[model samples]
Target: MNIPNLLSTMRLILSPTIIWLFLRDQTLMGYIIFGLAALTDILDGFIARKYNVRTKLGTVLDPLADKVLALSVLFTLAMKEIIPYWIPGILAVKEMIMVAGGLFLWNKGVVIPANIFGKVATASTYAAVLGSYVDRTIGLYGLILTVALSIVALFSYGRIFFKEKV
Candidate 1:
């Protein structure tokens, strides 16, 4: 695997550890690990784009890692009563649809890259997750924004998929 792909793999590995830490009531440790995993997400994308070492595997793995990390953390936060269950519930549905759509496109040898909407939605998701640690109200607004943006991204991806599939 290339460096970017390796970093994505690291994020995938760290996600469950972050969830475990949260489950054990180690919020601070979980946040630190979450930050590291988020850093890997940024670094991998930057390195892949800058070095032009993008691969089919990296394309799939990068976003899959991001989705897994974000969804796992959101679910853990909801389980801890730090955030409402509906927030993760909506996100889970959105992500599931996205995953299904992505797989369909992948089967047809099409890989749609992340657009600006998706990037903002992901950043908003992380912010929302972190905000829940401060104030539930702040987190709620952030999550609302995240959900709206995620839906927009979902539609955008769907549009791209149909365009490419044709």
Candidate 2:
């Protein structure tokens, strides 16, 4: 019950709340929840590192929560036609590819701890999707940032691919 795990659980709980708020068209509440969730996202990492409380569960759950929250929001927004149709498609596809690769590596016994670039991409995605819930037009910059961060994350994975013996 460290701060990191608590924050991760908070995010997990927030996901369905966000979806319900979005479904009810309660855009402002959705934004509030999303922002709080994002703040917890930042706080969790700092708490984990600051307190030396990092756990394997936190390491795994934090990123999975991020992906689920973000991808779900993107899908919800796309379904509402609030943003470009292709944005979610591209992000989801890339996410799936990376996730599959990660699972493959893990099956072969490599933990592949999360990297800085992945955190950046997750933050940008939360920002972009939350922005869409408020003003749908406020998406371009976040989208661009997501792509930039994704590139960095992919490069890190590339290094693992090139260097890992397995």
Candidate 3:
């Protein structure tokens, strides 16, 4: 309902459309839509923080939107042979582990916020996705960088949540 949440919702809605375009070989349109969705991601966070209209819904929807957008594009590109499977595979596994870890922590009444490493990984993934349209080499390097950052993020989150318990 709020502006921030609405923006997040827009990104969510746009995810499948972007994927559809990509799968259909509409690279330009896919990239444009993806860029717009990314813009919404930035705007939603800024608006939520600046206008003090942050909501729990926004908190949940924003990350969900980000995951859907990033993963969808990656999968589509991999399917089209535009990017290697290993890249999305690594990113996907990292995300799965992170989600499982988050759930475990939540069950134990711990809340771990997204850290800088995760943000860096996400930004790298976005770059990789965009770069695929320009040059596969750029995309490949970006994905490699993202995978590295994701590993660090996994370790960072694990350290944060498991340090006290272990």
Candidate 4:
């Protein structure tokens, strides 16, 4: 596998480790692992773009890794009583919708690339989850922002997808 694909795989591998650490009440260690995983995400995208090594596998695995990591972190935080259930719950619904939409479009022989709204939503999710480890207030705000961004992303992607079908 290429460096980008490898980095994405590493992030996927790291997801459960971070979740386990958090579940064990070792948030500090979890945060470190989470940071490393985030770093790998950034590095993978950069390396993929810079080296022209983006593969179909990388395209699928990169976002899959991100979703797994983010969902695991959010679920862990919610389970630890660090955040409210609705935060992850809503995000989970949004993710499910996005996945279904993506699959629908894929079945139609269309590929919808990640847009800025989705990226902002993802970053907001990361901020929310990470901030919860430090301060609940910041986490709440971040979660709210993530929800808003996710809505916008959903709308944006839906519009783009439907428009392409015409």
Q: Say which prediction, candidate 3 or candidate 4, comes out ahead on lDDT.
A: 4
Score residue 24 of candidate 4 by CA lDDT: 88
- Residue 140 C-alpha lDDT in model 1: 84
Q: Would you estimate the TM-scores of all the predictions?
A: 0.96, 0.88, 0.90, 0.93
Indicate whether candidate 2 or candidate 4 has the larger TM-score. Answer: 4
- Top candidate, metric TM-score: 1
Model 4, span 60-115: residue lDDT tens: 78888888898888888889888888877887887898789778877787777677
Off by over 4 Å in 1: none
RMSD of each: 1.1, 1.9, 1.8, 1.4
Best-fitting candidate, scored by lDDT: 1
Residues 1-166, model 1: lDDT tens digits: 8999999999999999999999999998998899889889889989999999999999889999999999999988889988788988998998888888889888988888889889999889888877877788998899999999999999998888778878
What would the per-residue lDDT of candidate 3 be over residues 1-166, giving only the tens digit for each residue? 9999999999999999998888888889999999889889889888988999977557667877888899888888889998888877887887788778767876776656667887787778787888878999988888888889889988998898787445
Q: What is candidate 4's TM-score against the reference? A: 0.93
lDDT score for candidate 2 against the true structure: 0.79
lDDT of each: 0.90, 0.79, 0.83, 0.85
**Which 10 consecutive positions of candidate 4 have the poorest summed lDDT?**
105-114
- lDDT of model number 1: 0.90
Measured with C-alpha atoms, the lDDT of residue 136 in candidate 3 is 92
